[model samples]
Target: MKKYRAVVIDGKKLIRRGIAVMTLAVVAALGVLDIKIAAPKINVMPDSIGQSAVAESVPVIGAVSGTAEKLKSSAIAVVKKVVSFVLTFDPFDLHTAVAEELPLIKAVGYGYLARTANQSIAAYNPQNVDTGGGTAEPATPGTGQYPITEVDSGQGKALGKEKSKILIRNETDFGINIDEMLSSPLKFDMKGEEPKVLIVHTHTTECYSPEGASVYSADKSDRSLNADENMTAVGKAVKRVFEKKGIKVIHDATVHDNPSFNGSYENSRKTVEKYKAKYPGIAVVLDLHRDAFIYDDGSKAKFVTEIDGKKTAQLMLVVGTNGGGLDHPNWRENMKLALKLQNHISKKYPSLMRGVNLRKERFNGHVALGSMIIEVGSSGNTLSEAVRGAELAAAEISDFLNTLK
Candidate 1:
């Protein structure tokens, strides 16, 4: 009225302020309503807001309550969306996605996948290790030497001392009559051209000293993955002798002692069973291995002898029995065959035979009538010497086996 410049009422600004005030009122109403719902019996309202004031605000509160319900619904929908996204995400897919852009991750991812695949395959085709059936025990200082009580007139004698006496290192309570066993006829009937002998390696990777090296590093294992350098090579030498003698033999180069040393006998047992199932006529199963002996002073023992002026490693025939509590009814028959072979081999080269080791463990010997573990040489010998020893032993063994019927 005093003619003050007519306060220009901006209508748009007034409308915006009105909307902001409405939103604040709605927020305050929701807070009060939440408190009322949480504490139904408590009076949390301010003293200034008497019964009449609350009655006046009832319509406004009711209008905003609907809006609050809509907002709660929207929030629940957003939570569901987040949960759905999380639940569907795959970590492997994520790894693949990230690996696509990163070169190092890509290489690592591929390697991981390959390793997992291999492990899965291995799980299905398990190669379990078991030492209960006997294993390659460490060599002692006087392994090949004849004991005072067990030595017979010709048994355990040197080449010039005795010709064909059977020496046995009996490690069991069971008594073995060498003469009786040698005289006993072999029970196996060798007929037809079917596979008569199955040669396998329980400790397939057992190796010997390198050529020209008398001593080896103690830290380095006396084992090799190369079939040409390990017991497989010795098996091949034996196979060759059998083949030359017109005897049908199966030389199974299956590696039983790789990726794991335990359960080697178990693994070879499976291999033997497979071959035996295929060739029911299989008579003899030879588990070829190299002996290992580390003395208290850490020096390895090498059981070597001279054969026709050639340095030859000595061989040992191991026969297993049921003393270990496993059922092996045919163990005695296996022992009989071993004794016959030992007698035969010793006659040709007396020093070549290191005596038959009779043990308690069945050693898969129950699989056949003529199953035995043949240790070609100790870790102290060379590959060449072991091969020669196996050839010499197998030649005589095959000859004797050929005569059995």
Candidate 2:
């Protein structure tokens, strides 16, 4: 009977030893796989029993190493199978199961489930997803697809003669007497060879649509840091026109909207002030920008018109007033200048001008006597179109400036 009891005890020891070896193998396999798991605490046999089992079972070091290698290979295979199962598991089905099983937990519902469902559904439906970052539908071919209301240069003339020459999209209560403002001529008493015009871009990174591309990227940003690709290029085009007409012009290609979109006006104000301090003769400070218009259907508007047989983006003169409670006394003068330029450009190209947008924000217009914001083209217009528009406007603008003296 004692011999029978010893055999049973030995069998129990062997089982304990096998359990320890299996546990060790699993822990090592998890480490190899780099998977994190909270292993349950197991009550192992005493050290003496474990040592005896190891000594009797794994007598040679070589045998013990060989057994360990086999266990490791088996553990690796088991881990790979578990990983594969987890990857293939349907998260939506699991969520549904949980919801059905625990109806009482409805008060603390899984809000993320709806988003997950949308993502899953979107993954299978490529047509519904705009993976190319462009508009859902391709844009209509050709420029000037959208019709613009041409300024009736004769309608408002009977009401207010000069004001009639330019349509004012007024957003302020400040009354503008166009005739009174135009009566006082814009004078730039130029000293020899000094810059009379200063062209700068507050939103310097504003860009146009891709050239010759019918489809516009909806998710792609309309801003770029590249000077050649952004508003700086437009400013350069305007400067070139001015210089060709023997007008000294300064183009401050400082980037004001980068790093942060906020405080762009403030940063640009500093830039204008710095240049103004350096060049006191700078009479006209033109803040150039590209306009952005999005329709309810997610299509961008292109304010484009053909001029001299070339495609040109339309120009808008934005004149800001002190209606926003800022001290801008020279706003009337700025309006007068904008009117003169708009009227002159309209005479040449009836549909070139998008009219003058009068707003409440000062937009640093009070910095100089002839400060105004000129929006050239929009996100839907190409850079070449915008450049052509700027050049045309600048030519007429230079002619007007030449008459100033």
Candidate 3:
């Protein structure tokens, strides 16, 4: 039998090398690594105020082995970018490591930033520019199910008639690229014709984003990310898709309506119980949340989206593989459902996703066999994108559910 290999690295340190129990891969801010099985790089370097940004963070120096050079370099570079992301770089010196040692410390300089690093409000993209203070390589311009518009604004003005326009104010990190994400392993693994799958979305009370994520709380109202709309929109989307195929759908979107504190899932369970009574055929559940590590770019806003080429949305998803609560016998079953969805999407749509994030904590994944919650987008994510993602999810999962046994 052909064996698979799972390489584990912590920040910059190489730790383990073994095929994971499951082919499921997790995504995070630091170079697209997973959360749980991930190994943090041990900072053998002296700690100081300079490397303050990563004071608590493990420096992702490289990957596990030499054979994985490209992977390792990419990972380390990503970590360095996040830690070194500062608002005020001297344009020549970008090294923020406080009186510290950098194993491969390269030249540090200034890059365009709408926000600074000291604030801790959000994170920056790992990809940086070249020596000329420019973003360097050509970034894959934003694309969507819509069209793109040009703007003639300040920066656009600064361009001296350079064709430039904004994609509106409120935009999403990664618009709901269900078709795109479905092709990546980070989404629901759909196998053939979608079955009558029922997914339940759970909400978290303190849904916040990591400092350097694509989505951040520009306004306080975005503190919770796009939790509510994620579930509702996708729920409805799935209903529409499934219903057309003679499948029944029910969503307890009000599971944690206006919940107080962080126990939204607890309240959500109450509503879920009610759902159990109404839709006895329910099979899948998802708890939605944004990530804490990844951030976005403010330099001309590359991560922004345009609907129909106009202003639109992008989305991110996180899934908890944690036992959820007390070890429920049905826990594995829930995972099976999650795996099924993830695999399906990975094969169908590859670019639409950031990646599947297998988390450590459980929101309420043990209630049923097909129960799993998903985090759509963060506050930085546009309301429109969040809505779009849910709908895309409904469409993709609706197709996958019909394939379930």
Name the candidate that leads on TM-score: 1
Error of 3 at 108 (Å): 20
- The sequence of per-residue lDDT tens digits that candidate 2 reaches over residues 221-329 is 6678888898999998898899998899899999887665545677788888898899888878999988665442344667777667888888888887776566788
Candidate 2 structure, TM-score to reference: 0.60
RMSD of each: 26.5, 24.0, 20.1
Candidate number achieving the greatest lDDT relative to the actual structure: 1
- Summarize candidate 1's per-residue lDDT along 258-312 as a digit string, tens digits: 6676567778889999999999999899988887654434456677887799888
TM-score of each: 0.63, 0.60, 0.43
Candidate 3 residues lying further than 4 Å off, grouped into runs, are 1-201, 204-219, 223-234, 255-259, 288-317, 321-325
- Global lDDT scores for all candidate models: 0.67, 0.65, 0.38
1 or 2: which has the higher lDDT?
A: 1
What would the per-residue lDDT of candidate 3 be over residues 158-228, giving only the tens digit for each residue? 33342221111211222233343333332233333333244554433223223334422222222332544
Total clashes for model 3: 98
Against the true structure, candidate 3 reaches a TM-score of 0.43
